[model samples]
Target: MTDAIKIDVWSDIACPWCYIGKKNLEKGLAEVASDEDAPLVEVTYHSYELSPDTPVDFEGDEGDYLVQHKGISREQALEMADRVTDVAREAGLDYHFDILKHTNTVKAHELVHFAKEMGMQDAMKERLLSAHFVEGRHVGRVDDLVELAVEVGLDADATRDALVSEKYVEAVRADEDQARAYGINGVPFFVIDGKYGISGAQPPAAFSQIARQVWAEHKEEAAAV
Candidate 1:
């Protein structure tokens, strides 16, 4: 039996490149899945907020906030987003940049933690990212996020109650703490097999190459035993 390769991904829902990174990683996995010697990959998404103090209903444009926080010119921010959008399109993802609603994602992360208990973490992660990036859904609200959880096969009522009660806040916080301990300063950071760390939104080919290398190393180690 092949051992499973664990992948820990740190990202935020509001992050545009994180969505692209997810698509890139999926493509990489699809490529590896067809190979006979590929090790099984088990992915777990962690929470990392780009703007934890962002209001639930932030007023004005997201670009304005970027300008205020990062002190980058509006043109620079737009250009950066445009570049990421191009990358996303190449990865076969449709990004609705105009409709994206920026807000605090702490509750959304909590919902993902709750979904982990139900064995729907991947589905929940995709849904949350899509809801924030493409669907213009407000992920900061407990009721809205509960509906998203229902779509991902979680119990909606229980999720709603948990969100309102802030049940998994600590779990989300723990992930943040872990990210800090690992010196992760950006989103879309990938930790392969808990040993190798790959940062940024790397291409699918890059991920596939790493997976193949890791699988080979595992095989050699096992054969020597």
Candidate 2:
């Protein structure tokens, strides 16, 4: 609604920077008036698969997959991972990429859409990212996804049923289509009020500044009308 600035983010559960971006967004929200002002902001997570072609049960390590899919040498992939790991640390995230089991996150994306239907999308999205990146849990499998949903206070049985029927797959696809239409080719992309586009895992201050600016503009336009 125009009463609140809506932040729509397209991200993948398996992306390290996506989790960091989420945290930074939270920091930004908190920076504006003691976290109470967060109610003025409405955030929605959208689906964007970084590696859609990845098999559900990928048989290799993250470095290997990066080398093959990213067209980078094994050493370069490791270096990149290490560099990101350091960045993640700066965000107060203890990311252990070496133990991370990377796989296709399509099913996980569907699970997030299901949570959105149930009004638990935020919790589900955070839990899924933490499960994969920090806890090293499997996200591509239905059973695992259900477990994560249950942890987020969603009904396990209902989640399992929805997943089995592939109920929210279309929602996930719609998100991907919208992302492409926006010419967004990266994860952790944030759209504020459907007008301002902020790409990548920008600093918390950037998010805070955007939120304040958007809220002011929204107010100004409303006042003018």
Candidate 3:
């Protein structure tokens, strides 16, 4: 069996459930680590914008946008946010839906690509989600994103140059293309070892179970070979 398992995650920073899913995945990783025979796992976060065309200075409320896009009532959208907020809170995250300023997250994903080049993708992803959902920061701005990258141990000037020059734009686009090819229609989708697909912000126990099952199957396949 391979000693390491690779987890590819497709998500966007503007996605509230993505943050919750990330937390749940972390819980699952911690649980798996407690198992003596658990294989090592490396995670890579990929770009998947929920609103690729959203303007930088979006004027309408997020509830209005959701209502318009999904044809759901404003009340229903609010209820959905409340449900997601409860899930996030259970995962030890604070989500301020009322204060959330929704905007295009393409630039944020670009920053994630830049961080990946610096081997700080995980830190950058966590910080970007926290900044957007909890801190209500403007993640679309290049300067603000650079500041966040620096806070996560990335080189500030390099990140600034990358953002200014639109470096890694192709990488972000590549991730989007891959997501489309995989028929992913939602954020927080996971591909485990390029073999199994898991969707949504599943429970921690569910993630743990999948990890264990995948690891076991990989081991058995390797033994047979």
Tell me the tens digit of each residue's lDDT in model 1 across 121-158: 99999999888877778888877888899888899789
TM-score for each predicted model, relative to the true structure: 0.95, 0.95, 0.94
lDDT of 1 at 122: 91
**Poorest 10 consecutive residues by lDDT, candidate 1:** 60-69
lDDT of each: 0.87, 0.89, 0.89
TM-score of 2: 0.95
Expressed as tens digits, the lDDT of each residue in 134-154 for candidate 3 is 988889988888889888999
**lDDT, candidate 2, 1-225, per-residue tens:** 448889999999988999999999989888985644343899999999988899888888878989889999999999999999899888888887877888889889999998998899999998998888788899989888888899999998999999899888899999999999999999899999898999999999999898888877877787888
Judging by lDDT, tell me the better candidate of 1 and 3.
Answer: 3
What is the lDDT, from 0 to 100, of the residue 187 in candidate 1? Answer: 87
Measured over all alpha carbons after superposition, the RMSD of each candidate to the real structure, in angstroms, is 1.3, 1.7, 1.5
